[model samples]
Target: MTSLTDLSKLDDILALDLPAPDAGAIEAARARQNDLTKPPGSLGRLEDLAAFMAGWQGTDRPTIDRAQALVFAGNHGVCAQGVNPFPQAVTALMVANFEAGGAAINQLARTAGADMTVVPLDLDQPTADFTTGPAMTGAECLDAFLKGAQAVDSTANIVILGEMGIGNSTVSAALAHAICGGTAEDWVGRGTGSDEDGRARKADVVARGVEQHGHLSPLEILAALGGREQAAICGAVVAARLARIPVLLDGYICTAAVAPLHGANPAFLDHCLIGHQSAEPGHARLCGAMEKQPILHLGMALGEGTGAALALGVLRGALACHNDMATFAEAGIG
Candidate 1:
């Protein structure tokens, strides 16, 4: 429950120069990988991914000991229009589940050696249903975004963003449609296992919202259709990059939040690592729009930072291999 005023605002962070992935660190990692005991290219993409991490961290040695996973939760008024299969109560309940460390993400973070935070952003007052009007005011959207920025742990080199809201997927698609310039029908998908009929109904909701406000700027698009959690995640992405932390992105709703940031600054993608591809229909298109490939394709749509937490282990292994593998000369093998 960090306040928006507690952290540096997204406006301030975006005003500063963002660091790109370091070329020197990347080359150094590649050289060391070639010198490792394994035959050149034997470890496959691990060598490449590890090198990317080095470049991201601006060092030949990249570590994620203080990885931070924040689950931003809130209610969407759009849920009242039958867009969600679940009740709005689930949003508040899940925040409690996160706080108790009883949710799947809690267990996953414990195993990943990452700290977890459940951020309840503006759940006290739900956004207006965008089918009729804007979800929130521009000021509110900026506040939610700043609160998201505040949630990040400065000590964390790896940041994971996820969200929980019943009808958020509908708003996510709406936001994406506005920012990415796609039809609402193309971006909307079933959330919480909505049936075919429910999907169409949800799609119509987004279409109506987008028809009214699709051409607005990033913050305007967010104010028009974005949910509280989505706004926060968007701000978090900007803040993480300001601190030069590599991001581990979750699925559809999360990426939908990401669309505006990508639209505003394509360089933001260079700092993101897609944790997994979601079963949500529009997610692949979202990733495709960013020209990013996910590390896992397990067809997961359960968003609570579950995918990112799972991916942390793989990152840790990559770091281990990069630092511990014996060189060919050291082992007298070449």
Candidate 2:
């Protein structure tokens, strides 16, 4: 695991040697898939998904014995700019709902057999408004990033990451615009039912933030434009990569949270799969910018890792077919 005591160490960690998939295990899994009692390539992406799991898990027969889901929540001060329809207090309320097992993510996590955890960064202390300056100081950003890294269960077969924050869609748009390079209007979206006027406001806020921060390194952009939960998501992604764990990223906000890491090192997201393409307009563009294909397209805009939790079922099904199905020789079907 990489020690991240200071924000300055982040660049070093991003540049450090990282693990790659096990070629032997991947080859073995592919061979097994070909031998299964079915025509070649009949299983479509299921076969590819199984091989992906095998490579990451370093096993021909990869299993999702322990799937973990993490949802990080924080309040963004940019809500002061009226970028969202809901108040920032909704963030804390949603966190409580998650803990009480009443949110969509709770039900989806339970159905998918994943252990769910909700980590709420200081709800009482929202990040500074990025329109005025950096959203978080270096110390604050590093603390949240470390908290995210610490939340990962290294023993799990996979991790699903999601987030909850009012006005964070604006934060995500700002981060995406800063990292991916586009007009603020291109990245802004209607978050939590923002009206046309609200979206315009959001775009203005994102544009101003990017202008104030200027062009900097990806990690610096994160500290300048990202909220606590966004920083945490980036940290969790790094920790998961270090542990060689596969990851399923939720929708727009979650994807944007780690966009900086991708900017820093594209290989940083090699082990991850986008859980879904959100209804949020910027999500599709962001995924396009990163050249990642999402696993589902249910028009879901909910943020609490709900999309990733639901995609867990698809992964479980793929593993089941890969690990439990009989071969042609064993079934005497050849």
Candidate 3:
């Protein structure tokens, strides 16, 4: 796929012919599942997950030899609205922690045996405050989007996407509300341990952002209400799809970041899976709206792809059972 040079060219990318999962591989995997020593359907979602991976990998036996996790960090000017208790500097500080391998995500990625990459999108220049106008200009949003798309490793069998941005929960709420069409309260959630009052303020800010932007195309909503990290997530999702790499989506912020793409085209998420259900209330509702059932529900809301990284272990287990287990004939059973 050619690199995206302009935001106007995004429509072309969305309209490009995308590959579908291999039906033959899916059938072969299902047959193997039935022939396994275990009783039919006993493994439940594991069985389905194995088939899903097989279909994407185009093989009855698939392995995740290399998995890539991307965490995009950006500062949000929306923090000026008092939506977050933490200062904006926290974003840069946390990025430093990620690089130093001290953050939770670093440990999680290491445990999952996935290579992690952190991309900080102009941390010194936050997106414009959306309550007053568009969060980012076309050029700024396009640049961040390209940064995300370029970060994907084409050799990875699977990709996990996440984001880090102070006051980004409000940006997420605004994006979700603009794309999903509900009261701002439906999308706002206490992020970074916001109290009730802070959540209320977030909701108010989201409401104002949506009102200011009004109804628009999904991409337009992204440019209007999304921050740099949010746009990067969207870009990464598209790049992964183009490369035929299955994706594991992280919690609320990550999900909301790509919600606009789903709004533009539901098929955009066909190769994607929700890693977990976030404790943030809006995430479940957003998942329902997107028709995605999460793989795990540990009540995790921490971003940075932590939940997705943990869920990678689940995928690895599914592949292990699918590829290593003996068939009933081989076991001389049944």
Q: lDDT tens digits, residues 213-311, model 2?
A: 958789888989999999999889988988999999999999999999999889999999999999999999999999999999999998899899989
For each candidate, how many residue pairs have backbone atoms clashing (under 3 Å)?
0, 0, 0
Can you write out model 1's per-residue Cα lDDT over 173-283, one digit (the tens) per residue? 887788777677888777788899999998888888888888786657777788889888977887787778888988888888878777777776678888889998888
lDDT against true structure, model 2: 0.91
| Clashes by residue pair, model 3 | none
- Give model 2's TM-score versus the native structure: 0.97
Candidate 2 off by > 4 Å: 1-8
* Clashing residue pairs for model 1: none
Residue 291 C-alpha lDDT in model 1: 89
**RMSD of candidate 1 to true structure, Å:** 2.9
Worst 10 residues of 3 by lDDT: 1-10
RMSD of each: 2.9, 1.4, 1.4
Candidate 3 residue-pair clash tally = 0
Please estimate how well model 3 matches the true structure, expressed as its whole-model Cα lDDT.
0.90
